[model samples]
Target chain A: QKEVEQDPGPLSVPEGAIVSLNCTYSNSAFQYFMWYRQYSRKGPELLMYTYSSGNKEDGRFTAQVDKSSKYISLFIRDSQPSDSATYLCAMRGNSGTYKYIFGTGTRLKVLA
Target chain B: EPEVTQTPSHQVTQMGQEVILRCVPISNHLYFYWYRQILGQKVEFLVSFYNNEISEKSEIFDDQFSVERPDGSNFTLKIRSTKLEDSAMYFCASREVGTGANEQYFGPGTRLTVT
Candidate 1:
């Protein structure tokens, strides 16, 4: 089984809607959770990062991690057309190696 | 604001040829990394370097691939003999230390098209 799994969602939503993207993992040793945004032909850029299990808020984006359930989520409030992109979730074990395991990104399109 | 920067936004090379992708990580950053993304695929980690040595590498980072911090500021990834599968976007990343945080800043990436 893949260590990290995410729905490759070509999800489309209208503007001003609340968007929730999620990923589930099969490993319990993962302690660092991160969300990245990637545009077409560009590299993945770090959006939000959380250590262990907790809720982290950064303006329009909120990242939550549940280590017990091995689940992580990113919520976007008031989604906009400019927010359309692929969101990838990545995590690494607490071993401090910093080698990340990434999920298959979900594509999102917020239409105006 | 400092950010990771990569050169040669796009490269097209023949198979079996050697190619070197260069990156200038943020000043004062202690950790550097190389990741790649194939067409319509997830970004995969290749290797991580710290203190002038490889800290970790994935299986895909085999004998053909090598990374070096040739200078205090420049980090590079050299593919000894490029394969058809080597066509992908190579991204460079760097993270600062001593802040009790490890969030990497990625470059725009160099699209390597192996012909």
Candidate 2:
């Protein structure tokens, strides 16, 4: 099984709607969970990061990690057209080697 | 506000040619990594370097692939012989520490197209 698995969603929603992006992993050793945003033809940009389990909120974005279930999620409240982009979930173990495993990104489109 | 920077934003080369993608990581960062993303595919890890040596590498980082931090500030990924399947967006990333708490900063990326 892949270390990380995410739905390759082209999820479309109207402006002001809430968006939820999620990923699951098979490795319980993963301690660092990250969400990245990528635009077409550009590199992925780090958006949110969390360590271990629990919820982290930054502005309109919230990242939640459920280590027990091996699940992670990024929630975007009041989504906007500018928020349209691909979302990638990445994870790494606590080995201190800084090696990361990434999931296939989910493409999102927020329509105005 | 420091960030990683990559050169030759885009490159096109014929199969069997050698290609070198360059990067300048954050000055104070201690760890470096190379990753690649094929069109519409997941971003795959290639290799990680520390103390001028490879600390770890993924299966994708085969014999044909090499990474070097020849100078203090510059890091590079070189493919000995490019193949058509080698075309992808390559990203360079760096972190101030190797711990899990340290966040990695990524470069804009170098898009390589092998014909």
Candidate 3:
């Protein structure tokens, strides 16, 4: 099984809607979870990062991690058309190697 | 805010040709990484560099692939012989020390097209 799995969604939502993105992993060793947004042909931009199981809020984005279930989520409040991008979830263990395991990104489109 | 930067926004090379992708990581960051994404696949980790040496590398980072930190500010990924499957977008990322070390900042990718 893949270390991390995410829905590759072309999830379309109207502007000002709330958006939720999620990822699941099989590796319990993963201690750091991150969410990134990518535009077409661009790099993955860090959106939210959580050290372990808990919720972190920053601006319009909130990140949640559930280590027991090996699940992580990113919620976008008041999503805008500018938020249209592919959301990628990445995670790494505290092994000190610092290599990240990434999931196939979910494509999001917030229409105005 | 400082950010990572990569050279040659796009590169086209023939199969069997050699290609070198370069990056300049955040000045104060101590760790560097290389990751690649195929046309529609997930971002795959290639290698990580710290203290001027390789810390870890994935299976996809085979013998044909090598990474170097030739200077204090430059990091590079070299593919000795490009393969058709090597066509992808390559990204460079860096992380700072101390607080929030796990937070890596990524640069705009270099799209490699191997024909």
Query: What is the TM-score of each predicted model, taking all chains together?
Result: 0.97, 0.97, 0.97
On a 0 to 100 scale, what is the lDDT of residue B29 in model 1?
A: 90
Flag regions of model 1 displaced more than 4 Å.
none
What does candidate 2 score on TM?
0.97
How far does residue B61 in candidate 2 sit from its true spot (Å)? 1.0
| Model-by-model DockQ, in order | 0.81, 0.83, 0.92
For candidate 3, the per-residue lDDT at A92 reads: 90
Find the number of clashing residue pairs for candidate 1.
Answer: 0
Candidate that beats the other on lDDT, 2 or 3, i.e. the better one: 3
In candidate 1, list every pair of residues with a backbone clash: none
Report, for candidate 2, the interface RMSD.
Answer: 0.8
What tens digits encode model 2's per-residue C-alpha lDDT throughout B40-114? 899999999998899999888999999998888999999999999999999999988734446888899999999
TM-score of chain B of 3: 0.97
Q: Which regions in candidate 3 have their CA more than 4 angstroms from the true location?
A: none
Candidate number with the higher DockQ (1 or 3): 3
Candidate 3 docks with a DockQ of 0.92
